[model samples]
Structures are given as C-alpha cells and as structure tokens.
Target: MDEKFLRKKSFALPKVNPFIHDLQLSMKDKLQILVMSFTLAPIRLFLIFILLIFAWLIAFISTLGLDIDSKKPVRSWRRLPILLLQPIMRAVFFCMGVIWIEQKGLPASRKEAFIYVIAPHSTFYDAVPCAIIATTVVAKQDLISAPFIGTLLKTLQPVLVVRHDPDSRKKTIQEIHRRASSQNEWPQIIVFPEGTCTNGKALITFKAGAFIPGVPVQPVLIRYPNYLDTFTWTMNGPGGLTLLWYSLCQFYIRFQVEFLPVYTPSDEEIDDPKLYAENVRFLMAQALNVPCTEHTFEDCRLMSQAKSKDLPMEAGLVEFSKLSKKLGIDINEMNEMLDEFALKSRSCKDGLMGIEEFAELLCLPITEPLKELFNLYDRDGSGKLDFREYVIGMSLLSHAAVTEKSIKIAFKVFDRNGDGTVTHDELDHVLKSVFGHDFETRNIYDKIDQENKGRITFDEFYAFVKKRPEYAKLFMTYADLEQDDMPQDKIHNITQRRASHALAGSSILSNVQYSNQGANAILKEKKDE
Candidate 1:
C-alpha cells in the first residue's frame, strides 16, 4: 500500500454523531447500563465488602473517640483502611480482567501535582481501571443519574464537568481552576476530549474545555495486547458488549498502560484549546503508530518503552569505516571528492564562472551513468535543474544502493512546489523533506528563514550549506559511489545504520542550520562546564 494511504487508513475511526449529545440514553448510556447490569452481582458483593471494611475501620476509630476529625487521626489511623483497600481493589480488577495500568514517561511529581489528563481505552470496562488508578472524576450530562462508579468518583471530588452549553464549559473551567487553587491533594480530573469511544485507531476530535491554559497536560496511553474479542467492549462486530461482559465475568485478559511526561501549554498557545488538544492527540498518535484513536496515554508509554527496547545497542554508533566500505570507496577519497565538489558548487562572487565552467565544475566521470537518470528529470530543456528535477535525479542516484523507499520519498517531498527546479528559497524545504518537521526543524527554520519569505534564496542556501558541508559532501559522495556486492541482509543493516546516523547528524546540523549561534552557545556552555 502507498505509505500515505496506509497512514490515512490506519488512522481512520468511526465518527460519533453530534446529535447523540441530545439523547438521554444514547450509546454511552446504554453501555453504562449494560456494564452496571452485567457487573451488578460483583458490584453488590464489592459494596458489601467495602461496607464491612468501612464499618470495621469506623468501629476501630470509635474506640479511640479522640477527635477523629484531627489530621493526625485521619492521616495515621483512619487512612489505613482506604490505603489497604486500594491494592485489594486493584488486584480484584486485575483478576476480573477489567483493567490494567501502564506508566510511561516520568511524571513531574511522584507525590503531588494538580493537572492530570487521563485517556482511558474508551469503554465502560476500561473506565474501571482508569477510575481506580487516576481517581478520575467522570464528566456526565445533567440528565443521567450518577452510576456506582460515578458516586464513588463524586466522593473523591473529581471534577464533575457538564458539556452542553458554553456557560457550563466556562463554569467548569472556573470550578476546576478554583478546585486546583484550593487543593493540597493530588486527585486528577480526567476528561475524554475525543468525547466518545473509537476502535483504538483514529482519535476523535478533541473538546478543549478541560485543558485550561497554564495547566500541565499529562497524556496516558493504554493498549490491550490480548485478544480484543475477550478484552474490549467497543469492538465493531457482534458479541461486542457480550464478550466484554463474559471477559469481565471470567477475568481472562492482560492490559498495559504507559504514562508520558507532563506537557504544559505555553500561555500564548493556550488561547486555542482545540489546537492544544490536537497537539496532544498528535503526540499520542505518533508515539503509538497504530493510529490516533488506538492510542491513549498508557499506549504511548508502553510504545515508547517498546521502541526503546527495539533500539539496537549500536544504534548511536557512527561507523565511518563500515559506511565507506558500503560505498565501495576510501573514506578520505570520498571526502576529497565532496570537498572539491563543494568548492566548485560555490557561487561565483562576480558571476565569473559561465554556464560551461559551472557545468565543468559539477560534471563527474562517475556522473555519466547518473546522467541518464538526470536526463530523465530534465523534462524542461533548461540547462539548470529545478527542485523536482533535482529530486528525481537524486532519488534515481540514491535508489541503486538504498533499499529504504523513504529516501526517494524524501526527495519527492523536497520538491514541494512540484516545480522542476530548486531555488535558494526552497533550501529549508529540502531539509524538511529529509528531516521531519519536528521541534528542532521548526527551530532551525525560524532562525534560518530570517527574511521570512518562506523560501531561501541562493545566498541563504549557500550560508546554510557552508555551515553543514558534511551533509552536502555525504550526499554527493554517496551518489557518486559504485554499487557493492554486499549481501542483502548486510545491505539492509548498513542502510538502517546509515539512516540512523543520518538522522542524528541532521539533528546536529539543525542546531547549526541558522547561523553559528546555537553552535557558539553549545561551545560556551561546554566552556562554562
């Protein structure tokens, strides 16, 4: 499948109707009802157990009769039963196959912090674990009565958010802010910005009411690695909720949760909550790779760890010798070739070099075979190459040795305008084509695109090139090298290694892409150290 199409398909999810908001007992209502009914027996048993535990604790405290409202009494003796019951409930839920937890990145606080955004797996079953772990206050419409968990959540004073009106949203924000300001405790308010359940693929459109400005947003990703048939209540086919109830009844699945680091939206960026939600959703999606909807905070955390595990021991190594061998050339020779090309490609100060001289400077004996490739891109008779032409040219040259299609994909991307030539204005565009448009790249462009014309002219391009001659040299030399007789597996290994190295180098280059400001800063910091 085409990569773009695959990406689109992977991210697709069922859309929730806005009209459902008006209905009292909508799908969410029905799901909740089913969950309550199905778990009615267990709920009653658990309630009885809770009552017994509570009664025992109260009786024990009554014997003291020494001002039970005191902090010392509450913290020391009174809190014991609840603390003890927590693990018991967690274990019960785990055994019941109802929920699991996965913690990801380090939290800002190991003990206490206010702003917490919990993303559950979007099912009544999944909600149990999230409610248990995060102490989530469920947001419900005023029409529905609070269910068993809802009553429990209310006791925790988790924010009870109502969603039908603008006035209510504003009031909700105010209440949250007020609660946050007054709280000395760490109960987090959990909101499902996607607003509805999905198939764990595409994320729903986020409602930004809960993400107040200046508040930290901690994303949690959740994943069910087992059979969805036995684990999830939100599956598309028949036996969906039934299977969920059976699974809950039988207790037969495992779950993983990942917690990502807390992210605080900048004051300036917070005005647009939708954008804030989208950014968070995007981060979560990218971390999980299964699709935006499939990801939750827990899934992201687990995925991060999984990816970290997959990283090779030599992932960070830059083996220049191995790279040289793959290119079938001496390292020093290739460097010389690159240096010479870089010098020749330099623009004439007074336009002294004519077209023939320029051609001579650029022409290579090895470029003969590549010329056929270049000619295929020269759709226009213009002697000079454009972004599109150059991209095709490079892609053809690079395709012989690199098996990863991403290299060619990068080439095509650099030719953003679909034009046949690349101009100085498109230099950053080319860089973005290769490296992703990540934070580092954004920083690079913000600094380099000083004129802000959105395109880099030749002068700007030359300045960038001079600062990162290594990349230009590497590409030129790689393009010039002959094919090697390495085994397919070895070639794949080499390609992967090179790609990683390239990404690292590009990151370093991005830091220096603008001027030498960041480079000088680094040096200064090192000196200071």
Candidate 2:
C-alpha cells in the first residue's frame, strides 16, 4: 500500500509504526559519545556495576531458601530486605544518569488495585518505574537464569512466564487471577501488557492476563522526553549495547511516569477480558497522545517470517490481531496461508501478487473477469495484493462463498448440454449469467480447456472454480436465479443488482472503487451542468 495514501486518509484503525526505530547520530552526538566513553561512561559503569552487585546480594539474602515457585507472598520479615534493596536499585539508576524521575498522579494502593498496567514499554530503561514502585512484575521464566539480573528479578517474586508454552500462559493467567482474588495477601503486580518493545510511536494490542481477573487496574504511562532517543529497543532498532553506550554517554536521561486513575471493570468488561485490556490501552494511548494500533507480538513473528522469505520485514505486518478478530482466523492458519502466498508471489519482486501472478496462481489466463477479481484484492489501487489483502479476499470473497455444494451446483448450471463437458458457448453463458453482460472469455475457456478439445470436463470446471473461489459467490447467485426459472433478461437485471450488493458486502475493494466512482460521476454531472 502507498504510505502517502494511508497517511492522507482516515482509516477505521490507525497506521502502525510500532516495530521500527532508526537511530541517526549527528556530529555533536558522535563527539559526545567519544567524550563520554573516556569520562562519564567509565565512572557510571563502575558505580552502576558496584551498586548492581550490592543490590543483587541484598536480593539473594532476601530470597534465600524461599520457594521461588510459591504462589503465596513472602513472609513479612522476608519483605524487609526488599525495602532496603529498593533504595540501592534506585541508586543504580541514578549512577546511570537517571538523576531524577518525574512522577504524576498517585499510585493506587494494593487494596485499591492489585494490578498496574504499564504501556509504551519501549526500552530496558523502563525498569525505572519498576524500581520506583518496587512491585513484582511478570517476567520471562528464562530471566531467572541471567547472572546478576536473575537474582534481582527473582527477589521481586515476579510472576515468571514461559513463551511458546500454552500451559505456561494458562498458569500465568491463573496465577494473576489468584493474586487478584487473594484480597491483599499478595503484593501488587505490574504488567507490561504489550509483551514486547516497540518504537513508541503507537501503543500495540494489550495482553488480557492483567485484565482477566476483573479487578481494578491502574494504567501507567512511561515517557522518555529526550532530544536524542537511544532508548527504544525495537526489532529494527539499535542493538542493546549500542543503545546502552548512547544512554550511558548522555549526561542524564529524562524519564516521566504518569499514573491514571484506577479503572474498575464493569460487568461487561469483567466477562470480556479483551475488552477490558483494550479499553485500558486506549486510555493509556490517549494520555501518551499517540494512536492505538492493532499490532501485537504476533506481528514480530510475522516480521521474522517475512524476512526469512526475502520479503520486506514490514510485508508480514498485516495487522494480524485486527484481521484475526474480523476474519476469525488464527496465527497458525495465517502462517500456513503465508506459505501458499509465498509460492504464488515467488515470481514477483516485492513478494506481492500482480495481475499476472494472480492469474497464474488460479491457472487462468488474463481476462476482464480475472482482472475484476484481481482488482477486488488489489486494494488501495496499488496494482498488487499484499498478504493482508490476500487474506481478506480469501476469507470474505472466497472461502466463505466457495463450498463443495455451491461448486457442484455452479458446475452443473454451466454444463448446459449435460454431456459432462462445457464448451465455449456454455462458458460464455456462465459469465453472462453472473455478470449480466458478455465478458471476453476465449482466454478463460482456453485456459481451462487444457486438452485443447474446445470443451472442458467437470474436473476442469471444478479445478477452475477451485482456483478462483471468488466466482463461486456470483455463480451460486446465478444458479439460484436459474433455479427460480427467471427469464434471461430478468436474471441479468437481478444478477446485476445482487452482484453489487454481494460484492459490496464481501469485498472492501468494492466499496473503495464504488465510492471513488460515485464521487467521480457526481463531479462529471456537476461539470455538465
């Protein structure tokens, strides 16, 4: 899709640029890095490392002999060391040039909200909020194995989650629910609902675990209002060491945290955890003054897939979360479909399908009918179909309309002479039946009649329909009109009317084209006047 067109138009959902971050350095910035490498960077690293060891030692003693997997909170005496460790942890950040943290609004008490949902989780520096609050976090289970950071993270008794394990996700949710319902027995938990870092231009979809318990949650926003951004840790951004070097070189990193009001879920939100999470995310994005996007961690996986397939990494960013919700498809299904898409698009330069590739994939030659179908998928008039467009067309225009029964009925309707074969006249009749007019179909018929016998058997017809499933909807509509024993003229009129309605309902491209044509026609009439 054209980025300019996307920016100029108002879309149902905002455009997402959450996963890319490019760091461009100026001469002054380079000089500062050179200067700080010798001066402040060395001192900061030394002091921060020392403070980290002290903090880790404190955490080690505090967590000693305690069951790391315990569902219950630690005893009161065990919590005392954490209180001491918090100041040391704060000092570590201070040494790293986070001299001060500007906080806004009051944080909710444990009784008011057992969960705090943080957003715009863009960098490792975001740990400042965790340190300031001294709350437990939902961390990766693998973090427990990290050298010094592992001991420190364990000290907070974070809810450890294992990615790629369905049972682990279930247990994490169950554990969150348990804590929320424990009535002050457990410490307040903080969740970065995005589950991954972004470039911070937009807020991505929030995971529902924190909101699942139906308890009150305080939405927190983190911002780094700095002139130079060396903090955002995105998949396309600078490496951790590069960001760390840039960050350490800076005299002080500006950080701010704003706590929104504690949100108590209503009955509706309680029942629908996804709704609760979305509402909370929307509120946070509003506070951050950035758009909320449908992008999620799933896009990261898709981006990786795109890269592996030699397509632009952004090609796989099909706003999978939103498409899944609308189309009722899952990531695994999309992944499988992507493999098919890759095969069809292999001849194309950009990993997208043009009209030629579209025809080749369906085993049909280019014709007006094929062009129409390709146009339906070539949304944005870009003359190509991206993965998102392909998926949408497949879901709404093809799969939903193309079924075994419908295909059989349409094929029978096309075989007028009942000789188990369809000739050119019958193919033309089939097109006229659905389109209400003639479409040059010599190419279409020849493509289907691979044997060059001037006739296509039922197998050929079925194969053609299978390749172009979008036609099934129109074919079935025509078959229905034929079953009613309508006159050809009457069938044509009804088919024309119904075709507009069916395409309007099933194809987004249809709406875009119709709206554009309608506006053009209106303008032409005005000029005539």
Candidate 3:
C-alpha cells in the first residue's frame, strides 16, 4: 500500500440533541408544533372542553326547563355539577404539566376570610394551574379571544377586560367583588402585577389597580426550580411569543408551583393605595429574595437624619407660634429670625466635628447645658454619633458660640487619622489616653462594647460619656482650647481681673502661699545632730 493511501480517514461525529441545548424556544417553532399537535392530538383537550360546555349547558337548560330562577343559580342540587366540574378542570391542568400544589400553613377552614391573590411565575403554563385553583369564576377579558383556550375560557364565565378602558376595568373589579362577597368561595384572582412577563429572575413593579379597596393581598410566590427553561414565555427577545400558535406548542413543558403565604391589606393602609401596593410589593420581594424599590430600614434612617434640622424649622414654625403667643414675642419677628438662622446655618462646613469635640470647642460640658444638643444629634438614640450624626452634632455645637473656624479645627483634631467619621475604637483610644485612670480601662471597655465585638461604636461611646458628667466636663474644657481662636480680649481681661482680685485680698494671696514649715523642722534636727 502507498504511504499516502494508507493514512487513516476521519469520520464526522453525529449531531447532539438541540432540545437539550436550547435555553428558550423561538415563537415560530412553538406555534408550528402547537398547530400540528392540535390538529393531530386534539382528543384530550377537545373532550375536556366539550364536557365543560355540556355541563354548563345542562345547568342552564335545567334552570330554564324546570322553571328554576336563573339569577339564583346556586340551588343546593346545582352545586353537585359545579363540584364535579372542578375536578375535571383540575385533571386538565395535571395532564398539561402546569403545577403540583402542596398546601402549608393555616388550614382552609380556619383561614381568616380574605382574598387570595395568586402570583404564579408569568407564563402560559400559569393559566392551567390558576384555572384549577380558582373558585369564584376566574375571568380574564384579555384571554377571551385566545385561540383554542378562548372559547373554553369564555364558557367558564370569566369577566372580559379591556386594558385601556378604565370604565371596563372598574366594572370588572366591581363584578369580581360582588361575586366574591355573595359566594363563599376562595377566588384565586391570578394577576401578573408586572402587566407583562419576563424570565423569573426579576419582578416588575406592581400596579396598584388591584389593591385599591384594601383587600388582603395574599402573595403566592411560585418557583419552577426543575424546569425554568420550559416555563418562560415573553413577547420580547428569544423567549417571547407574539402569535397564538406559539402558546399551544409551548404548553407541554413541566413546571412546579409554590404557594407562598397570603398578604392581607391593612385597614389603616386603605386610604393610601400607592403605599399599600408598595407594602405588598415589598413583602413579595422579600419572600422572593428579589430587590425591592420600596423604602427599607436604611432608607428610613437616612430620611430621619436628613430631616432632623428641618424638624425645628418644620415644627418650629408651629411651635414658635405657640411659644411666641405664650412668651409674648412677635411671631413674625421670631419667624424672620428663624429664617435668618436657617439661612446662615445652611453652610455645613463646621458640621464635620464629633459631638464631644464640638462641645469642648464651645467650652460647654455634656451636662444640662447640652441636653438639647444631645437630642438633636442622637438620631437613633443609640447615644453615640455615627459620622453623619457627629457632623450634624458639631454644627449644633458651633451654633452655640464656637466660631466656624474653631469648630473645623476641633473636628480635624478629633478625626485623628482623618477618616471623616471618628469610630468607637478611635474615640476609645483617645479617651484611654486622656481619662483612663479615672475609670478602670477594662471596665470602661466592657461598658462601651455593646456588641462585645472588642471595639466601640459611636453610639456606645456617647452612652458612656453621658453617664459620667465630671469626665465629660473636663474633656470638653480641654478640647475647647485645642481650637486656635481663643478670644484674645477674653484671655487678657481674665488675667488682669484675676491679678487685681488677688492683690485686693491678702487672704486670697495667703491661701495660694506654699508653706516650708516641715523643711525648717528637718533643718533644726540636722543642726542638733
């Protein structure tokens, strides 16, 4: 054999399954499959739809033929057929592979009579599960014209809705409420608050339309853990479906449904619909572990801190008006003065100092003199100043006779390492160097370390200083002088006045005299020796 001819030939590998590889199916492919399946394998769905129509028709015909009232459709005997129909609908859903519901928490009998707002992961698969669970005549105006499902859905007596028609939407809500109130049934009103669908990772902002009447909104958070790819259907990107054909072909995908605890709307929250919606949205977000745009703990803290100064101004106008009436000060004049103060105080340059340093710079102790100052700065009441709290506190301190320049210098000194905020550890170290001998360092540390994390936070430090007036007074007095602008006239006047007062009183001078009596006694004993 020739060397070239003897060389081995390679064979091409077989193609892998595209169904396993593709993340989301295209709309065109899904529709084609749905049409073909409906044409060929229409028996199960067709029989179910026919059975449901026959059952409803029989009820209608019996009421008419037997002279039974149409308005009062729920006669004792009529309930049997409706009860039988529920299982049929459930069977259809099971066959479709939509959901396998497992109930937890409070039992159905004891559940405080309320609305169950079902939120399934937005998908066409959601329809079947929603239909199975829904009790109070589930209706969707949008789904009235939907392909094979539309005729069946209409026959089921769903209230049709027109999205842009406000009047129609309002009517739908009223009708739903009426039905729910009259019929004692668990109406699983499936509403996608996002108003559109996306991959289950993100939740769109909830619209407040459904929650208006302050009905308890039970949030049912569903997760499709096993088959996420099979469940997603959108109108955008690779996963979306625009035409009717796309939905049916995509219906065979397997899914899991989790019904989270119901969220009840508060009576107090009814008037503020937006706020109510936000609360529900927040709860849903928390349950889902998704990020919520609603106000959080941190948000509230920030708002409180920001509005602290405005408190006096916002409350001051009314308070000052009352005080002015009682104190007999001109309300207009006080208001003008307040405005001026507010304007002058707008510069937060001196606001960067710590509360202790600011107090010291003004020669004010953390005693009764600084009570208002403490309250103004201690936003959370934890006692110590965080960086923001410290800054605001310094601003308040500076207003009490400490010049802006002096306040800035004092802040720079206190903020030793120059991190904007003086943390508890830095404050403690400074305190240890200054007043460690006054109290046992170990005991002081134990008291200040609230978390026992081996370091103090600003709140802890503040609490410690507040408890000891003597130490606070001494610290403040020393800190006041650290600032360069001790008034020259004040120092000179004090020195001169003290000298004149000492000269005027010989007794005062004698009290200051140092005695050498013991020294003289020792000298006499040495001479005798």
**Alpha-carbon lDDT, every model:** 0.43, 0.78, 0.43
268-380: candidate 2 lDDT, tens digit per residue = 99999999999998888888999888888998998888778777777788777888887788999888778778887866678888888777665545655567666766667
Higher-TM-score candidate of 1 and 2: 2
Highest-scoring model, lDDT: 2
Candidate 1: tens digits of C-alpha lDDT, residues 359-428: 3433322122223323433435455443222322222233223312322332333344756333444544
Q: 466-507 in candidate 3: lDDT tens per residue? A: 433223323332243333244434323332333222222211
Best by TM-score, which number?
Answer: 2
Q: Residue 276 lDDT in model 1?
A: 80
Q: Give the TM-score of candidate 1.
A: 0.40
Native-referenced Cα lDDT, model 3: 0.43
Give the Å error, residue 189, model 2: 0.4
Higher-scoring candidate on lDDT, 2 or 3: 2
Worst 10 residues of 1 by lDDT: 311-320
Segments of candidate 2 deviating more than 4 angstroms: 1-13, 346-349, 410-468, 471-529
Error of 2 at 366 (Å): 1.8
- Model 2: which ten-residue window has the lowest total lDDT? 2-11
- Return whichever of 2 and 3 wins on TM-score: 2
